[model samples]
Target chain A: MADSRAPDPTRRSERSRRAIYAAALALVTEVGYARTTVEAIAARAGVGKQTIYRWWPSKGAVLLEAFLDLADQAARAADGGAGLHGIPDTGDLAADLRLVLRATVDEMNDPAFDLPSRALAAEGIVDAELGAEFARKLLEPQLQLYVKRLRAGQEAGDVRRDIDVRVALELLVGPLAHRWLMRTLPLTHAYADAVADLALYGLAPRP
Target chain B: MADSRAPDPTRRSERSRRAIYAAALALVTEVGYARTTVEAIAARAGVGKQTIYRWWPSKGAVLLEAFLDLADQAARAADGGAGLHGIPDTGDLAADLRLVLRATVDEMNDPAFDLPSRALAAEGIVDAELGAEFARKLLEPQLQLYVKRLRAGQEAGDVRRDIDVRVALELLVGPLAHRWLMRTLPLTHAYADAVADLALYGLAPRP
Candidate 1:
């Protein structure tokens, strides 16, 4: 659907881009990253292969952009304009982390995000070059948001100043990613809260 | 090479088993899970297709068992015949945990373990049934070792009694796994020690 406010001239291009993105995501999810071809994506999107070639250099680039676009859409849908880039810093660090993590839990569960992401991530695991590219473009930027939030927490004296925000953010993110990737257990808001609590307070007994 | 010990009747079977394991691991690493076939593993191992079918049900089963056997070999090699079932309980929780995580770091770095495991892990990400089976047979069992160790920590008053050991173990295993799978950073002994320390001590300022 074209945005009503947009000039009529650009709407056709906008529609084509959306169709390509949808097609790329669906093809990758259905057939997986290794098998999904640019030609197939073009066919599925009802566009010429040249149109896709006009934009992206390879299938990997198309899928990466498609995923980023999907994430942006999911983020907007979840929080009404406050998308994936920002974690709400409501002064309560634990509360803020938990809130974002819960949203992540929801996002991870959504089939639209889950299937295509799993396909891409599976490829990334064995294909080092592709994995690194996806990590740079898709993963690290999101993880950096946590780093920013944790740094803010340090300024607010909520998190320890001596701790590395980068590493500490792993403690926050790593467990969730592990569970989600492995399907070891159900990820829930309660799980997010507990992780936040454990991270703030060590697993060892308080003195 | 056959084992020096007699029990002569089964030596041929043992050799074939080892050959199949090696071939399966090598083929998966070279070509990936999808392209790797039972026929290929059999041919590479210099065995008949019937021989493979006689032992394992499918290519997935063969690869799973091969990985398990490889892990067993790695474990035995690491600790002078001590295998995968237990984590050392030195009565010092942090020290013991660090030691185990360090061994894990070493294992993750091994080419023999790294490539095939990555192939399997990548497949697991997209294939739900395969993923669940690996988690049950290979992963969850290993995680339970940490659960056992943490319970001992609780009894010794080293760990907080209120924590869920299952979830707590994720705090131990998750970061290592996430880092290992994502290749986000170097998985070193120092990183393992830091994760251990952070888990034991809360990120908040010490009183």
Candidate 2:
């Protein structure tokens, strides 16, 4: 007779994957990108070094995946664990943009998200190859959400038809990112509202 | 009689200051923030370690001053050595902004400014105290120039009186910075022109 308590291989693999991601994010935040090593990550994750090597080719790969995972978690949490599939199409472009931006402000302030993301972003500034990869894999996808929402707004006549959605989305996202990274000023809901208003209506006085 | 060949103290001090700035920038780019040291900067500048410490408390201080100096050099060069004291206050706000932003695009593309500034900015992202210091010393001063220009625009009724000049300035500066730092898109003169138009005229259609 065989024992009935054997764990499933798929479940075991997933557990290991989550552990590795946690370890990667934590280690990078604590020691920074330059000093974080695969061996160290493996040790912290309670996995053998070969297991990490088998799954990821380099530390950058591990860190990028970890960040993607963290972002998903943050997004899901913001959307009440329903999963943030896309920007909500409430038909009110201003309200939708403001909602998403406020969520972003909260995420930026969360220490769990803030510290590690800053580490990855900081490394990305100096590391061109890694930066491009993260931009493609992580940053672009996030920006695309705004693009999708803006395009939807244009279709619904909430946004101007002639607006280049891509560049227009930058007006929504860029100021917040600049202020957060540079720490120039507080990133607040009020600030987000101001950006949305300015982007939508503009700064020129109406006749 | 006093020896006429002896170096003037003022001239010697200015020469040493420039040399130290060059040395600090180069070392940070080569070895990164954590590894770049006072001793190394002193050695590269051909000054005693005491000379560096006499002026700066740490590598952070030295690097901040170096960046401010580099920015001054770039600005002076852009203005044909006249020294850039502030943004030009031409009656046409859009035209004046376009001129300054184009110059900024050129500066961002230049390697001498790009590499060292990235090094310092990368460090600031992870190091809070240093980030705040640099923001106060270097970034804020640069931003204040935009603030002054915007205020001028407001007075001239080019910008809406109700708009916050500080926030309005971000719409001008933020997108360029976001594109340049994240490498999300090509930072071009045309792009800057679009941002200025979008910011000034609003993204929505006029009635």
Candidate 3:
């Protein structure tokens, strides 16, 4: 018979994993990506290096997973614990995109997401391998939600059938990313709405 | 009287300036922005460290000037020495934009611009001060060119007067920058044309 006071091995491991992720995110935010080493993360996490090595192959892998987890938490919070099912679709493509982009602006403004995400993004810019992995693992999945919605829109006769949904999505995403990354202008709800409207209706005057 | 065979002091100064620019770009590419120092740039440039101190206040300042010169060189080469007056105004907004964006795709493909620019961009992402400085100094000027062109477009009835040209330009620029920065896909001439087309025409089926 197990002792009532004994710490469960499964629960302990889960706590260690969460600790490792917190350490990774905190270290990356404080010192940036290149300087946030496995040794530092393990030390900060109060876990043995072997434990981290057993779960993740490299620091990049750890940070990627950490970021994914953070995004999941934010999504869950936003969707009332539903998780990131997909962007909401209410048949109006313009309204739906505006709603989503507004939420994106809110996320970009959040320091919890902003600082660590910037650190990872900074590294990904110079490190092509990491950048590609990030785009594939993190960005591409989120982008696919837009693709799914646009495909649905095509079926509903909202989006033009000839439009390449993939490239079309970039019109909205690119401006936001550019504004956010470059820090050229304030990333605001109004800006998001303008981007959605411009991308949907275009710069040319409606006939 | 000046020695007849001796190098002109002005010409010698110009050569030294060019050499400094080359070294700054090269060092940053080889060692990255964080590690690239003014002393190292001077050593690589074959000049005294005092010479660098006499010019730029910081390494960031030196890199900024160097990148500006590199962009000027690329532009002059493209326009056959006409210099970067502005984006070409052929009156046909679509064709003009297509031609310019295609050239941009070619520029992004150039390794000379690719390597060093990536280093600076990586640093900018996490370092908000540097990011803001680079944007104000380098990016905003280039963007202003688009603002000018779009203003002309509005007058010619190619673009809507109500459209915010500042944000409108991002639809073309954001996608290219996102693709180039993230290396998400093969940025091609065809892709540039698609971005331009989708931007000019509303995504919704035209009535």
Candidate 4:
């Protein structure tokens, strides 16, 4: 009888998915990953538990997808439709990096992003399987963007050809990650720009 | 009573203190910070729960002090009586940094150090209060060693006078921390040496 009165299953599924993502993020932020449960998420999301289970194999998977969705939304908002894919290639590598880093500072500071991200990141630190999954699914792809840009710079002769782009990207991003995660200093655009300059120009006095 | 029979209370207290620290480290590594309890630590140390409470205010305090003790032990073991209290003043800053970083690689890879340290670090990532305590108690003092060395270099006309020693030190340590925490690559002595060289010499070709 319920199947006969079809009210667009696809739309209903999409709605359920968004609600589940919201519930999952909120639960993790509030109670932390150790305590957050799929059943609780489904209850808060006002959907059947089987609905969430159908889409994600576990709570970790749900959270990961939720974060990806949030990132996508934030990226779209920042670029007005450019989305969260790669840094813009504006010919000048330093300027491009600066722009991206500035955006990153904003994202990192955003409460919508900050609270849930910290919860997930903190969970990942302790759970080796979860941490590896998070790194593989989320972090590595974003890092690949830097690899692509650095390769472009290498071809352009802006970066040294002998340098490993992977390691070099760490120099660019590591300090910011350290500061952001540890809250050692203010995560500001100026700070990001300064990091970019130091990494690009080298700390030694130009001969 | 055994408490009244002590020839030297200070010596007896020191033994108990060491036992508590050892128990804290082992408990955290096995059960993690969330499940680790003062009672558990006390039990494992073969001391009363009241003994732990009398000496330390909280589980976090006990863990922090234990970690500090562990770090001091590792440093003393690495540098003998001199300890890792100061960066070596070998006149050549790059070479000195390389020597310390190589030791760090060894320390980070050691299981006795790595397991408990990772557990503590993982807890700190999510627990802001604990993380701040770790920085204030442990990481900052270690970092100041680099600051002193950089200041010496500035006096020697090797480092630029205008550079912020704190930020500059990050340029050297941040990349290494990133690689180690993320498990992106093998953290080797060669890798450490390269980080020191690149940070000191810069990525650009020397003119």
Candidate 5:
């Protein structure tokens, strides 16, 4: 596999792609999504508009790719040298969830991620096609990481067998999303821990 | 208290106000929040823009009031000869939550409520100040009812004493909100019941 790839043209193209992604994200965040144009992004990235058009069909497509790149960078940064996409399965589900959620708390609080995310999320809420595209491309993939972790727990006999992994993951994720979107309260380590505990043990007393 | 109220003019003003609210909701649903104007609403209602201004401060204010009225109507309709806003206790927290959530599913699915509400929600997502105001005035009050019910559960020992009522309510509300906002899957009675079960009992098997 390593010998099958040549680095010359690919490396140069990768650098250009990174610049374009950076420019797209910055422009959308700086100005609103409605105001962002292809020419503007190309100008910011020092690329021709034809180059952007050649790569992506529309401004939304550019923004979607930009978000995907941003999320990947965030995931790598968050891996903390583990290079894992999900909570570490240390044979302790609760502890693993807490560790991941604490990191998520930190991430959600980061200004670099939060501002542009909020702007994009706000626009997505109004635009159905955009929102659906975001879900398919960015949000669903991140959520699938949770689904994988939950399935692992289920197989390990930690999670209940009857539970739907998809919906069950929502119990773990939904509260945090709601808090972040609504700005109802501060998203903190304490809050994350509480959500994890509640999600694990539930509100009802164990029989 | 009932006998000391003002007479016919107050009643007439109330009617016009209701008409104006209806008009505003219809216009927003049809034209979307951005294109929706006070002039359009007034024209739709067969009233003057000055009349709308005399009573309300801005288009956001008008939309807010319109939503409040719509919610009241929904609540009254759902109440169905019962008291408004309290989830049925029946000494069963899970069942009560499921019942309330099912009603919410119905309300969310209702075309009359869904269209305008979605329009407003879409606009609110993009507009921070407006979103905050709407959440504070309309959404928060509705959520507080859940808080009160949950606190009652705590007092009755049905709910855990340690769980934050505010956050715990999100465990109940968040999944539903996520499903509605994202359209990730079908929102059904069975789904609502499952969420309540998971929220109350958690994903982990009982030890």
Candidate 6:
């Protein structure tokens, strides 16, 4: 039976999707990946389990799309809805990098992102198939944004022409991830700025 | 009653300990940390379950010690028995760092170390207390060796004194771990050399 007073079907579907994504993230964060299930996600989202199954084949698929949505939200939030056109290229490589990394440091500190991300990363590390999928779908694309920024720098003569930008980018990102994951030291904007400084100095053209 | 026919008690205990360490590592490698048990470790080692219980408080403790022992063996192998005196500090800081990083690349490639290590690291990431202990006892000391080498480089005028060596060391080690853990790219000696080269250039004295 068609209901004339009902909300738009497309709009209703979109709302349900957002609820499911939020529910999935919260469930994974609170209970961890092993314990999180589609049934629980559906229950928490206040949506029928059939709705989730119709859209996604498995819990992993649902979670992946949920993360994608979260990242999209973070990206939008970070840049005032510039829509992840890639990292800010203000033409000052060092300052631009520092700003982005500082934002990253803040995001890492946010429990909303941190706990769920750790749970996924831990599972990803043990599950090779999931690890590869994670890298391919999520990590590599984000890293490629750095590549774009570096390439832009290279053309502008700010970064060394002779250096491998791929390898060079790691100096900027690797240390931050290491600090965050290993808990070897406090992660802060100061550290992010230092990394940007060190890596930029390293990436400078030969004397 | 003491068994006179037994090989000296101290030697027997040492043998048992070595066997237990090997078994613990192997079991964890094969079955993962969650499935690994004291009884299983004891059975695999051909020692009584009480032996593992007597020496270690938990499976995590046993795995930790097993990892420690493996690291000792790796260190011995890396340096030909001069002991874990830290990274080699040849006068040429760049070459010395490259040598050690290359060795690290090899170790990361070795399945004997890689599989069990991945299992523990996976668990550690989700388990904060265990992660802290692993870092404090295992990871931080190894990183300090980089600090030692960098400090030596600083004194020798090869590295800039103004730089934070602790932060600088991450430039050397972090990229490797990131690539290894994320499987974003191949882990290789060439990558190690590139990291060493870029980081060294970054640590250079200002013009």
Q: What is the DockQ for all candidates, taken in turn?
A: 0.75, 0.73, 0.82, 0.48, 0.50, 0.48
Better candidate number, 3 or 5, judged by lDDT: 3
lDDT of 6 by residue, A22-110 (tens): 99999888887878999999999999999999999999999999887777677666556754568888988889899888877876787
Worst 10 residues of 1 chain A by lDDT: A2-11
lDDT of 5: 0.81
Query: Number of the top candidate by DockQ?
Result: 3
Error of 1 at B1 (Å): 16
Kept native contacts, as fractions per model, are: 0.71, 0.69, 0.88, 0.41, 0.55, 0.57
Off by over 4 Å in 4: A1-8, A78-81, B1-8, B78-81, B205-207
Clash tally for model 3: 0
Q: Give the candidates in order of TM-score, highest first.
A: 3, 2, 1, 6, 4, 5
Order of models, best DockQ first: 3, 1, 2, 5, 6, 4
lDDT tens digits, residue span B4-98, model 5: 85678888788879889999999888877888999998988888889999999999889888998888777666556343457888888888999
- Model 4: CAPRI class: acceptable
| lDDT score, candidate 2, position A162 | 79
List where candidate 6 sits over 4 angstroms from the true fold.
A1-6, A78-83, A203-207, B1-6, B78-83, B203-207
Give the CA lDDT, 0 to 100, for residue B52 in model 1: 97
The C-alpha stretches of model 2 lying farther than 4 A from their native spots are: A1-6, B1-6, B79-82
Give model 3's docking category. high
Residue A180, model 5, lDDT: 74
Global fold similarity of model 1 (TM-score): 0.93
List, residue by residue over A11-126, the lDDT tens digit for candidate 4: 88899999999999899989988899999999999999998889999887898899899887776666566778888899989898898778777878888888888888777766
lDDT of each: 0.87, 0.87, 0.88, 0.82, 0.81, 0.83
